[model samples]
Target chain A: MSFELFSNLVGAFFTLCIFSFLYKDNPFYQAAEQMLVGISLGYGLVYTYNRVFVPYVYQTIIIQHQFVLIIPAIMGMLYLLRFSRKLGWLSRYPIAFSMMGVGMGVPMGIHAAILVQMRQAMVPIESFNLFLIFIGTIAVLLYFFFSKAHKGVYGKFVNVGKWYMMIGFGASFGLTVMARISLLIGRIQFLVNDVIGILK
Target chain B: MKKTIPLLIVIVGGLIWVVWAFSPHYVLQEVFYNQFYLPWAYASASFAMLLGVLSLTMMHSNKIKMRAPKWQYSYFFFASFVITCLAGFIGGIQKGGLFMWMFENVQMPMSATMFSLLAFYMASAAYKAFRARSPEATVLLIAAIVVMLAQVPLGVKLSKHLPTISQWILDVPNLASKRGIMLGVGLGSVATSLKILLGIERSYLGGD
Candidate 1:
């Protein structure tokens, strides 16, 4: 069969197989799930090898052929020792290194990007609709504040916060609904366009 | 003598890398990124992948040895895993080969299948969850129905006004709510990262 015909046939079959899961769990869904996991893993491994290891290692060791590459390469090899119970302790060296690296990187990375950005977002700007901005900002901030008791003078502010929070949640719920609706429309379109070819 | 020294090195090295990242000097940044960061990420990820594969192998091997009832399925899984790995290893040399074929044909279809299943699952879940039993649920059900109807061309043909309402619901209120959620999420993430950085959340290190 032609590639187009083959693709159309396979697409239709997959669409049905996926929909079949609604009735009950079956071998088809299981097969599809397992195949997906395997393929994704396989692809990820290949991509990583090409993109990361080759450049980093080959440049240092083979091309530039620096002696320093040997240290990291050996450290990397120690990771394989994890499979052996006796040598598993060696694996911890690489693991510890990775954990420390990530732990250290995250905070430093977030310092400017997250903290600075958040502070900027909170800082109100002058606008003609200052009342709305003021109300929204103060109410949102009040919604988060929990150190002191929210009563009397603070109670009114807390109530305003409650209203803003509710509106925020309501709006979020509405967006989620719309997103799901869009997804549903896309599937229906697929069924119409690909399966029946009516749209075509 | 053996483990303690390595652990200390890791800790000290990690602190140095963090400090270097925030440093104003270009030399420190170059050393961290080129010499340390990229290599470390790759090496760690590779090891993690290897560990995952090993666990998969061990699990299936045990199932086979014990003659489990679903051993046949495990065998299928193992066979597929080995075949795919071999294909990848071989096909990596050639740009478009058996590995690429399997990925595009077998893998892509399966992923699409899994994704499409979400539609049916959502429908059933919505049927159960979106009951208009209370004032809140009623509002939810109404919003869902309106959104769902407005998405389809049929809704547009039925009433031109609905699309505008849907757009408003999505743009104004939805955008505001999303921003609020994002702000909360951002704060939570910052807190968690700080905790991890300070060694307060040492659970990630595999225990106390």
Candidate 2:
């Protein structure tokens, strides 16, 4: 068969496999799910090795013959010791180091991007909007404040916050719903355009 | 010796790495990235994938030996796994071939299906949630109805104003709520990372 015909056939079969899940769990769906996982893991491994390890370690250590790569290379080898129960404790050195490294790296990276941006977002852009911002901020703060009962002067502020919070939640829920609906629409479009080729 | 030595190394090494990452020196940053961070990520993920493959093989092999009712299904799974892996290995040799085909044909559809399943679930969930038993429920019901109706062409045909209202709802209120969520997520992530860095949350290491 021609390549286009072969691809179209494969696409049709996959669309069927996906739609089969709607009828309840079945062999086809299970196969599709497992295949998906296996392929993703396999692809991810290859990508990581090629894109990261090859250039970083293989070139620097193997080709350039750098002695500094030895330490991390040894650490990498130590990770395989996890297969043994007695020596597994040694493996935690690498795991802990890596986790800590990532833990430290993420915040250091994110602090400037997310935290700073959020603080900026919280600050109102307009003078007239400051009142709304102040009320919204105070009300939201009061809603979370559990140290004292909001029954007196703070009660009104708390009420305002409660209303704003409700509106926020409602809007979030609405967006989430729309997102799901769009997914459904896209699937339906695929079924028509690709699988059955009715739209063509 | 088992716990103390490893914990101490982690504590000292972690601090050093943290300092190394934030330092303004370009050389220190490059050393950390090339020598420590990248290699560590590759080693951990590779080992995890090996464990996953081993588990998959073991599960299927057990089913086949026991003559389970779904033994054929296990065989199919094992065959698919082997085929896909071999395809990827072979395709890697040639730069592009069977692996690309399987990814585009099999994997993408499955991902799309998994995401699409959320639609039916969300619809069912919304149906149950929007019962107008109280004033709050009534308001939610109305809001959901408006949003849902506004999304479709039918709603727009019925009222010229709905699309504008939908845009407003999405842009102003939706943006505000999402920003709030993003802030919460940011704070939570930072808190969790700090806990991990301080070695307070060591559950990720898979031991007491």
Candidate 3:
């Protein structure tokens, strides 16, 4: 058989091995899972080394002779010292560096996630549906606000919030189930089309 | 000294970015990011993955040394790692090479199948857990049923309006609640970030 055919057969076999977990955990499932972990890590490492390390560090510094690049290079190296029990404290520098950068990007997050969403929620009340959405959004927000005692008029709004939240959760769960089913469909397609050649 | 120094680094590092954010000048925004921050972040992220790789190696090696249960399977991990790395290094990562071949034949199928198994587990969960015991449970059940049925062609055939109702349910109350939750989460994260920068949150310094 050609390499492509052989590879497709192997792929289908492993795919079945993984699906065997629905029956019960077995040696085939364990082997496939272990191989997955190893392969994923190996693939990630090679891509990072080739794409990031080689281009950014090796090419920029060694080939191009940008001596200033040594600063971050040393900092990155320091991150590996976390494995050393004695020098693990040094890794916090790089950790802090990355965290601070992420922290400073919060304004952008607020702009996109909060301001934009709030803007979208502020629809013109031309339709009763728009008005319902407006109330639903406020009620849901009030549901999360735990400072006030949930009684009287406030309690009624909070109760409405609960319904909205439940519907939201239901919608999300439905989407998740659809996604899972699609993934199963994809695997079945592979089995039939590629492995058995039935579809062809 | 350790805690103090890291906190100082966090403050100083944060201040640099905040400064960059406010700095509207071309040189400050473009030149600074390209010259300094971008390279540092890239190197830091790559090293971060190396830390993960190191931790996994250490954990597996220790397990192997003690001959833990399923220790033989650890060999599978090591063997696959070696084979994959060898393939990538020796033959390159593009098509027709061993690396891409192994990825297509082994890694992609395994991950896809593993994720697809969730469909079975979720189906089982829905069977056992989706009982209507209360008004709230009944509401959730009906909404879930409507959405689920709407996804299939047979459901649409059964009732022409099923898809339209599902779309309305998702687009209205569902979206409103999601936006509310998103706002809360966004504000909470921003607050925590500010606390971190201000040294009020020192959990990242390691100790409880």
Candidate 4:
């Protein structure tokens, strides 16, 4: 067979290997799973080595002799110390450095997620749709409020919030299912057209 | 000394961000952040990815050595990993060759097929679990059906306004409720970060 045909056959085989899981988890599925894990990691390892380690660390510090860049290189090296038993405590330095990034991200998160979201929701209720949306947003917030018991006039608003949340979740579920279905359709198209046409 | 210094690093780093946020000065924005902090974080992420690769390698090797349950699968892992690494390193990943071919044929199809399997399982889940036991459940089911139908031509055929109603459902209630959830999460994130910076949350240091 030609290389293109051979490639299609290999693709068809692995596709079948994965689809076998729909029936039951057999060696075929397990083999494909293992292959996926291994190959993805290998791809990641090589990509990171080339794309990241090369220009960022090796080229900058070693080749260019920008010695200040070695600070993070040394910090990065500290991560490998995690493999050592006695020096495992040193690994915390890298962890802390990583956490610094996370901690610093709080102000950004507050601005984008909370403040901007709140501002976006605070639109003037010019129409029925806007009124519904504004009310729905308020209700959802009230539903999340736990200090007050769900028994009074305010509780009614909370009940409305609960309905809006259910609708939101349902919409999300529907979107995800349809996306997966489209992906399935693409794979089936590949099998029906590409694989079968080559055989013919 | 090891633990204390790391804690201090997080606090001092976080405080710098707080200062940057409030001040908006060029030195903090350009020199300190863009020049120093970003590159350091970028380079560190590479080392982190290397750790993940190493961790997987160690796990598979140990599994094979110990003859763990379904340990034969580990051999497949090693073989594929070695073969892929050899292909990439030897053929050169930057140019189109064996590595690209394997990735296009084996990886793409298998990954897409594997995820597509979820559609079948989701169909099963929707049928078995999504019962309209209460008014809330009924609303959820109706909304789900409407949203799913809106994607295809059949829903439009059934009712001319189905698409409009579906869009309204998404743009109004769905967006609003999602925003509420986002606010809650953002608040929690800020609180957690503050606790971490203040040394109140020592859990990251492998403590209670």
lDDT winner among the candidates?
A: 4
Residues B1-208, candidate 2: write the lDDT tens digits: 6666666656666676677766867666776666556665654444444545565677778888999876767655666666766776666724348877777766776677678787787778777876767665665566556677788889888998987776655555444444544555666677776676676766767663
TM-score of chain A of 2: 0.76
**Better TM-score candidate (1, 3):** 3
Clashing pairs in 4: none
lDDT of 4 by residue, A93-152 (tens): 889988886655778889988999989888888999888888988899888889999888
**Model 3 over residues B1-208: C-alpha lDDT tens digits?**
5678879888887877777776787776887677778886775577777888898988899889999998888888999998999999888999989999999999999999988899888888876767877777777778888898899998899899999999988999898889889888888888887888889988876752
Docking quality level of the chain pair in candidate 3: medium
Winner on DockQ between 2 and 4 is: 4
Which ranges of candidate 3 are over 4 A from the true structure? A198-200
lDDT assessment of candidate 1? 0.62
Alpha-carbon lDDT, every model: 0.62, 0.65, 0.85, 0.86
* TM-scores of chain B alone in all candidate structures, in the order given: 0.83, 0.76, 0.93, 0.93
List model 4 lDDT by residue over B1-208, tens digit each: 7789999988898788878877779999999888988888767768888778778889988998899999999988888888888998888795468887878888889999989999999989888768888898888888899999999999899998988988988999899889888888888888888888788887887631
List, residue by residue over A64-140, the lDDT tens digit for candidate 3: 99778777778888888887778888888888777877556677768877899999998788898788889999998
TM-score of chain B of 3: 0.93
How many residue pairs clash in model 1? 0
The 10-residue segment with the lowest total lDDT in model 1 chain B:
B172-181
> lDDT: which is higher, 1 or 3?
3
Weakest lDDT window of 10 consecutive positions for candidate 4 chain A: A97-106
All candidates' TM-scores? Answer: 0.77, 0.80, 0.96, 0.96
Q: How many backbone clashes does candidate 2 have?
A: 0
